[model samples]
Target chain A: MEVEKKQQCSELLQLVIDGQATQQQRHELDEHLPKCECCRNEFELSLSIKEGLKSRLKKPNLPSELATSIQSKVLELA
Target chain B: MSVGESMPYKSKDKQRVFNKEFMPHIDAMYNFAYRLTLDEDDAKDLVQETYLKAFRFINSFEEGTNAKAWLFRILKNSFINNYRKVSKQPNKVDYQEVESYYNSESVDEKITTDLRVETVQHMIGDEITNALNSLDIDFRTVIILCDLEGFTYEEMAKILDIPIGTVRSRLHRARNLLKEKLVNYATSMGYKDKRK
Candidate 1:
């Protein structure tokens, strides 16, 4: 029974983190999280991991000439 | 016109759609391509091919729709058909192997418990990027789409041509694997596991 609840919390926690959870789902996680130490830790860790990925990674800009070159090639196809 | 049916736009309209709807997404497209190919030249070539294809098929696109998603679908398909054939890393793990491996293991407990928020917070950009790049392509892709690109599960399903359930499950498994990798990296770097 404990294992089953653990599995449910993980799935629910992810849905909450992803912003895909419904109001009910979010409320459910909020209630469950206080009682579950394992899930509370997992939730905090997952959020931090996601935050780190979004803020830390550098998104490379497109090469300067690549778009212009693609434009020219696309025109030639006409 | 319904999807898959050409709208027969005038030549000028085709060019307008190409510039107005598609050109704006070039940078995001390039970033996605680079991540998938992991090589600058190949990424450039793939983006170029995708743009040309997008132009040729502009008639199939509807104005004011999700232009980014459409462009992404084309780019993903082009990568599979073209770049995957010539990818230098030939040791690509089969998707079936990845599926079976994740299915056979209870990876959640192993990954989630050991890694701490402080350790992950201390990880630099290069460390995070390397960890992401080292994942199998399938796992890496889900993370890129969901976390970086911010695609919804339904949109991801259409883009990747998998069911929404598959997207959810794959994302769950991918995050677990990524956490496991981070845990391993932290342990190697002498970060103490307080649980031990």
Candidate 2:
């Protein structure tokens, strides 16, 4: 791909991955991805990364007492 | 009296809003604070401060508007105002420097990370968490907001006080930086990139 074309594809790829792509843009990317190995790889990798972050990252336990404490404090202020 | 100006709320209504709208997002708020501060005690203080401020200014928050985003905006601002200077994270990189560097000539260069999708899928929670935590705070923030918290670009733009264009670009840069870190971790663990 030419430099300009690649940059445009990259941007469109991001839009699609982020779920911000317009329907037309999504169609355009779908048409282009099958023809471009680089973009297909990028799209897949980016999606996988998002998936990993959502599912694999550990959520810390919110301190059990913190909410109660904040509630009491808010009660005081109110 | 700009938009989002505080409206008059009865004390009863304020309590209602605080319990119904704000309290539900406490877990998310705590997670965001922990990610930003990367410390337990600080996260606790930051979240408490945010909630108190939220209650004090509850009138400004319209009832049906996005409470999560509004709360996030407050927590983010509080983090900047109070905690950033005393951040335990050493050698914080300036956001301006990172932004300029990412926007320059190398912006288009695809960061080569030697991690396959399979490897990324196989990564444990701690590996992914460590990779995320390793990023500069600004870059780390976009990922947390978009990926973990599921904020839209518009909401993110509002929360971070940046333009929509900046939000898009920053998220792009942040994801690539994260990918690089994940791939580096994969390589260190002897995972191979089948594509390469």
Candidate 3:
């Protein structure tokens, strides 16, 4: 792939992965992916990373006592 | 719109508003604090300090608006001003510099090959968290705000006090850095052809 085309593909890869891409941009990437091996690899990489983040990085739970502590602390300041 | 401006500052009223608006977000605040500090004691102290500040400046907050965002701004500022001083790693990059660097040609070239998809394909949650924690504070903050907290780019920009474009670029860089860190794990796991 040409350098500029490769760059364009790279930009689209981020937007698509981030869920920030527009419909037209997604369409453009979908069209480009099949014909280009490099872009496909890049796209798959981006997708896996995003999925990994979402599935693995569970939200940290707050300790049971933390909320009451915060509440009392704030009230003390009042 | 301004908090406690229209309504008189009665103690009972303040408590009511505090309970309704501010208290519900404790989990989120705690999570954000813990991620930033990476220590339970420090995170608790940070949250306590954040609440103290928020209550002290409750009058400044706009009522019925994004209290979560407002509290986040305070928490982030407190982390930088107080925690960062005691902590070892201070943010060294001027965001303007990062923005300019991303605008440059090097970023485009770097992204093309920096992330090897096969390497991180099999990473588990703990490994991913480790990768995230390994990042610099700025990069990690973006990931936490966007990926972990599900803040919109606009919300992240406001919370982090950067422009929307900076949020996007920083998030992009953060993810790529994470991918680099997890590459070894993915490589060891062996890339399965799951795409078919």
Candidate 4:
């Protein structure tokens, strides 16, 4: 597996999504993404996949009985 | 054990708060527990115990802190202090035994057809899941956290109590492993071989 030289924009794109981008980095990527085709597509794809996953995650409902029992146990320990 | 009593606390008013707030979180906790314990029954027991401990220590939950993260903190502590009985975790699978590096590499006389590409693409999701399940827990958890759960590298570091560099490197390894698995599954499914 050859390691491709990671573009500054790719790094920035990841940082921005993770909310770890600094002001300068964010500004730079914001400017770069429109001009950089690969970075733009990558960012769009990741964002779409993220949203799709969250939407598709089935309603995380436990059984009502499980809830009742766990709740009692929670309060008991409290 | 409540028998036919209609479950005494089932009617308690604060019970609504518990149901609405804490219960839905069990699945996530179960998933995380499975990763740590690697046994369904043990994971289930750990989850139940974690919930019990959470209930006992619910008052210590500071209101403003993210409740889910707090709950995870409690659960992680429980695994570490109470249930990670061994001094160290078991030996992991030697990735070398599984790594088909020659196949992973681009080479002559191999793999360049449209039908194969389509088949490979189609099985990506399930293959990725199997690959993830195969990796050592640490690598798999980082991938699940960063890629699947969309946690920031820093957040993953905090959750796993590792450094950010470890998170990034592990994420890279995990993703590559998934890609390899997808390719192998497609090939071994004999989709590519039969057409040739």
Provide the lowest-lDDT 10-residue window in model 1 chain A.
A1-10
Off by over 4 Å in 3: B1-10, B94-119, B187-196
Question: Which should have the higher lDDT, number 1 or number 3?
Answer: 1
Could you give candidate 4's per-residue lDDT for residues A1-78 as a string of tens digits? 132323344446657765778899889888877775555655664454334334433333333455566666666744
Writing each residue's lDDT as its tens digit, candidate 3 over A1-78 gives 665666577778877776778999999988988998777877787777777777777567778898888788776777
- Find the 10 residues in a row with the least total lDDT in model 2 chain A: A1-10
Clash count for each candidate, listed in order shown:
0, 0, 1, 5
Error of 1 at A65 (Å): 0.7
Root-mean-square deviation per candidate: 2.3, 2.3, 3.6, 9.0
lDDT, candidate 3, residue A58? Answer: 56
Q: Compute the interface RMSD for candidate 2.
A: 1.8
Show model 1 residue runs off by greater than 4 Å.
B88-106, B194-196
Order the candidates by lDDT, highest first: 2, 1, 3, 4
Residue pairs that clash (backbone atoms under 3 angstroms), model 4: A74-B55, A77-B55, A77-B56, A78-B55, A78-B56
Model 2 off-target regions past 4 Å? B1-6, B88-113
Superposed Cα deviation of residue B17, candidate 2 (Å): 0.8
Candidate 4 Cα outliers beyond 4 Å, as residue runs: A1-13, A16-65, B1-21, B35-39, B80-121, B190-196
Name the TM-score of candidate 3: 0.82
Q: For residues B1-196, what per-residue lDDT tens digits would candidate 3 score against the true structure?
A: 2446554557887788888999999888998999999998889889988988888887777668888988998999999998887888855667677666555555444554555555565566888888888888999998888777777788888998888878887887676667667764454556544453
lDDT of 2 by residue, B24-114 (tens): 9999999999999998898999999999999988878988889999999999999989988877655655657756755553444455335
